[model samples]
Target: MSMVVTSPDFRWGLKFFKYLEIAKVNYFTNTTYLANFLSKSIMVVLRIWIFTQLYRVTYATANENEIGGLTVPMVIWGLMIAQSLNTATRPQLSKLIDEEVKSGVIAYSINRPYSYILFHYFGSMGRFVSNLISNLTLGFLAAFILVGPISLSWNGLLLGSLLLFFGYTLDFLIDLMIGLISFWVEDISAFNWIYSKSQLIFGGLILPLSLFPDYLRNIAELLPFSQLFYSGSRLIVNFDFQLFQKYLLIQMAWLVFFWLLVGYVFSKGIKHVSVNGG
Candidate 1:
């Protein structure tokens, strides 16, 4: 038998797989994260349950099909999707970046073979993958059991899941930008706080933007945070292919913009590397 030969493309594919495998190992190897995942997941279940009941009480007379421009099931399901995305891709690594920057440990990263930012980005992706699996499994079960099934077809669920993957990229980029701000500012907590509140308000965490005053809703629709949770949640609950394409293209555009912005910031930030604290 002739010796086996691997093509360049095949070799590249193998390398890519290995990269993802390393990321997985990095994320899943942590024992504390597993505990935190379980605790937060339980809290999410209770939160969703309470919200569902509040809606039911408030809309006591409304039909199941519609409530404040959204169907009952849509609101419940939207909350699940929105919260799940938030839980899965909330950019925890940004804090690590900030800590590393503060302690000057980040300088060590320069000697590593891979780009520092890309390493963090992929690490975030690995966490996203693990969080997605855990949150979806536990959150969906809890919601279904407590609030009953929210109306969504299998196709819609599949489409929403696909879009969420793209959404994670947006989340990661935004967080990376915030984390990079540590390079300029002495305190990034202010920036983090601002971003968190902005995400909640503009991303439609408690209610859909459509229910907001027209001016505010229109503004929120234009904000990048909307693409993170609001768009994905709406797509899951409503299942509009045309709308999905629209939001997907919007996310892609924002992704490119942030990617370029991060590159620029990283270039400038590295130049000012004045490491303090060991």
Candidate 2:
């Protein structure tokens, strides 16, 4: 019998295998999924209880007067919207980047045809999609149970969805930029801690910017963090055309800035080579 042998496409096959391995590792060891579910559940429960207490207090104190131009329903909606829009990507991104650096696998990734930034982008998209589905479902359930069904017009719903998606993309890119700093820094734990805390405060996850003092509110509005939650929540409730345009423009500007920054950092990180002798 005659034998026939064909050479394999090693380069393409290797690349595909590498990506598959990464995906498998990420899927099986996704601790964030459990952590997110637990944390979000606690947050939703605590928030609902707090708001219910506030409503009782307000009813006892004043005879149906407006608090900061917000009725009880509006306040409830604002809280729900803000909580629902409290999306984040950095905690996982930082940990992934730090792991790569510590394990010395980043050197191999740097030598690959694909940019590390793009690799991280793919991994982050996986995580974000997972969280998006989980969080939105939980957020909707919490809103329904606590605030009841909200009546958003079709146009409002469409615009709010668009804004929310764009806001998420912008936030993801910003987190990637921060994660990339791991390439230069020895340890990123402190950076990650500070960044997460800042997000909690400035991203309007704790309280909507509407409740802030005027000066603090203005400062928060100018920062990119506000776009993460404040913009999307405001769109759902208020739907001001002019403000929407402004926030969208701001998101675009930050996207451009981070895109350039990531490019620059990747270029710099790739230039330094440290090959370990096997």
Candidate 3:
């Protein structure tokens, strides 16, 4: 008798393809096309407009390089990159997980072939790809119209893309933990709000950390939140290879930490639900 054989990597590739297919289906079936497009367009336009004015006015009399370690174009590009990642990597896992828990549909997910968290991750990537392409197109067009272009070499672009993947994964893991917390909390909105604000304030959303006061900037540098926004955005704008390695390392560390935390909570949550006959 002859038997078929496949490599482990090949099997995993097949699994990823399966989840990606499901994600594509969800993206098309679940998305409200016109509403999503119009809303995203408005958001990108408004953000690009506001930041263009803000940076131009703020840097009017200042030396761009010395003031915030950023020029006007650099600031705009940083914002563009950050916002792209924001829209692209906005994990829908928490909301979906919450709905499934409430509907008692999570039990069905337990029988699924893939890891639940990874399934959600891959599914989010499907939607994210759509959002990323559209958002970047709209955002970069608006940015060019408003501020002209920001130069990034091909090597910078490649490194920045690599850093962005790590940053996005770190963000996804964080979102995963928050989603898993739904097992204990009735609503995770407050937690999400806090996390978003932390990113806004400390993750270099409003301004680069270089522009912040020493104390505040120091704190942000030490936080995982900075890796989500600041590190990736800075890599895009600055593209320092040494800093790239450092931030990539930090993001990897945080990803591991959060992954372990999510696993622990998941195991414990499952036990609790089983005991309660959920």
Candidate 4:
């Protein structure tokens, strides 16, 4: 008797392809997925329009050639990059976690072969990647038509892309940490609201951190929020080696801090979890 053998690489590739097929089927069958995609697409367009108007107004009043040591094109590029990052790492994962906790389905996940954190991370990453491509394409076109083409040095573009990925990872971890708190809290909506507002106010989503007041900017720089946008945008528009090193350090520190915090919370939450009548 002869037995067939399969290589591990082939097996894994087959599994991944199957997973994508299943996801495609799910996407088509699910109305909620369609609705979510539509909503996200509309919001991305709205944000690009609003930001473009603001950029135009500012450029019209001030010299189009001068603002924060950036030309109009550079400012527009920075805004587009920041918008892409925001769309990619928005805290949509929090609602999923909250629903699972509230429905007592988390216990089922806890018993799964895969770790809950890793499962959620990969799932959210897939969603983000899909959203990032869709949003970036729409946003870049809208921005280019409204604000013209923005130029970037080859090295700066490379560094900016790296920083954007780092920012995405850091932001996702932070969002997960916040969502994990729902395991203990009775209601997480308030926390979610506060977090969303904080990101807008402190994360430099709407405006560059350099444009903020001295004291406010200092506070933003000290926190992890600024690391999410400032590092990526600065590299795209300015490209300072020393500043990049400093921001990278801040991002790493926050990642380590949140990893430990989430671990501690998960341990405690798992121990004390009581399912209605369990």
Candidate 5:
């Protein structure tokens, strides 16, 4: 006699597939908004153009081919790359959480069969992918038209791409933490503002660390912010093996810290949540 065996109809991986489905739905949904797409695309071109002229004037005044070891083309390309990824992880995640928390709708999601944080992350990722693709295309087109191409290396490109993934993960984790804090605090606007500005000033959003003095650059070496916006752009402008290695180490350390922090915050946040049946 033989026993017949059959697999379970449901699998753990199905939950992950749901997450992917969330991302996919968001990506396609965001792409359908032609007005938003046009506005973003136009802004990418406009910003790059304005910067290109600024770089030309600054270089003309200084009478240098490169400043702080950075060329006109280098900075332009860096801005294009930085700006492209800039829109990837928006503070919209925090706003969504804050709104849900304020509305008491988060209570409903608590009993859902999926991870709440992962649900939000995957949902945001859908929009992130849509924005990234459109921004990159416009950024590169504008950069190329105005400044010409900058030389790139295999290692630089590869490492820069990895850094972007690391950056996005860390960014999402920070947003998650802030959003979860809403369970305790009524407002997260201040937190959001500080995070945004920190990323702008220190994360190399508009200004790459390469534009700074050697001492400042050295200081940035110890900062994780530089790893987010600066490292990618730095490698784009000029790739140094030693610098790339150092950035990898810093980024990994920050990623680990934030990963643990978010877990703790989420657990605490859930306890504070008050629920009402809808």
Candidate 6:
């Protein structure tokens, strides 16, 4: 076969390395503007404090060591993970896609040799990690101050991290899908609102699914949104290998579903770009 350099699958190592360098650059870039993240960082601290206080009162009032097999400390720590994951990735990733579509800038990228989706993926990843680390630090520190130390095992941390990576990737795909909608709509703000609310209500970003009534928890767990936040967050505080495996399967299933969906949407969206003389 003739040499192939343009496609990612051709010399996958080099392509992956290139993507990683992009991530590294973004990570460092995010570290520079501390103030840019001030609002979110402050929210992380405040939410942790509020949740801890709220739950402490709840547990105390009820005189229960655990509600639905979850302790107050677990709630605090899980919310830290949930908030960090929720807030870490710039919500602007989808906005970037929206902007490109509105300005017809995406048309130029459409015909480029490399994949546009992958380009944005790697580009956002650097900043995503940066934001994630910063948020996690603030969250964990807040939790520690509020609740003292937590006991965690090495295996739990490692496995929980795997779930986190899976969740983040799935979440990014969700954002990408929302952004791609800009091709059809003049504005994607409504879509964004619906998505954020869904994450909150279904993803259990505020309340762990465990605390939900049995019927609701069952329904929520089946959604990709819960996997985006709750599954990994729950795994961090209450690491269960069996649940991890189940979460992995559910996430993988959604990943494949979204993967095909994104392809279909992008393919249709690109046609619109062509019609727009892009």
Q: Residues 1-278, candidate 6, lDDT per residue (tens digit)?
A: 55567666777988788778877887787777778866687788998898998999988999998987688898899888888878887656788899888787887887876788888888888887778777888888899999887778776788788878888889888999999998888889999989888999988788888889999988888899898877877877877888888888999999999989998999888888843552
What residue pairs are clashing in model 2? none
- Tell me the lDDT of model 1 at 126: 75
TM-score of each: 0.87, 0.77, 0.90, 0.84, 0.91, 0.91
What order do you get sorting by lDDT, best first? 6, 5, 3, 1, 4, 2
What are the lDDT figures for the candidates, one per model? Answer: 0.76, 0.67, 0.77, 0.73, 0.80, 0.84
For TM-score, candidate 1 versus 6, the one ahead is 6
Top of the candidates by lDDT: 6
> For model 1, how does the per-residue alpha-carbon lDDT over 173-277 read when each residue is reduced to its tens digit?
889898888988888998888888888888877777755778887677767888887888787777888778877888888889999999999899888786565
Residue 63, candidate 1: Cα error in Å is 7.7
Model 3 vs. true fold: TM: 0.90
Tell me the tens digit of each residue's lDDT in model 4 across 1-278: 12223777776776666556544543343324756765665577687678767877887886555665666666666767787768765547778888888888988888975567867766666666666777778777877887778666776778777877877777777777777888788788887788777777777777777667788877787788777765787787778778777777888898788789888888887875667865
Model 4 bad stretches (over 4 Å): 1-35, 276-278
Could you tell me which residue pairs clash in candidate 4? none
Question: Which pairs clash inside model 1?
Answer: none
Candidate 4 overall lDDT versus native: 0.73
Candidate 5, residues 125-213, lDDT tens digits: the string is 99888888888888888898898888899888888888777878778888888888888888889998987887777787777676777
Q: Flag regions of model 5 displaced more than 4 Å.
A: 1-12
Q: In candidate 1, residue 79 scores what lDDT?
A: 82
Give the better candidate number (3 or 4) by TM-score.
3
Per-model clash counts, in order, read 0, 0, 0, 0, 0, 0
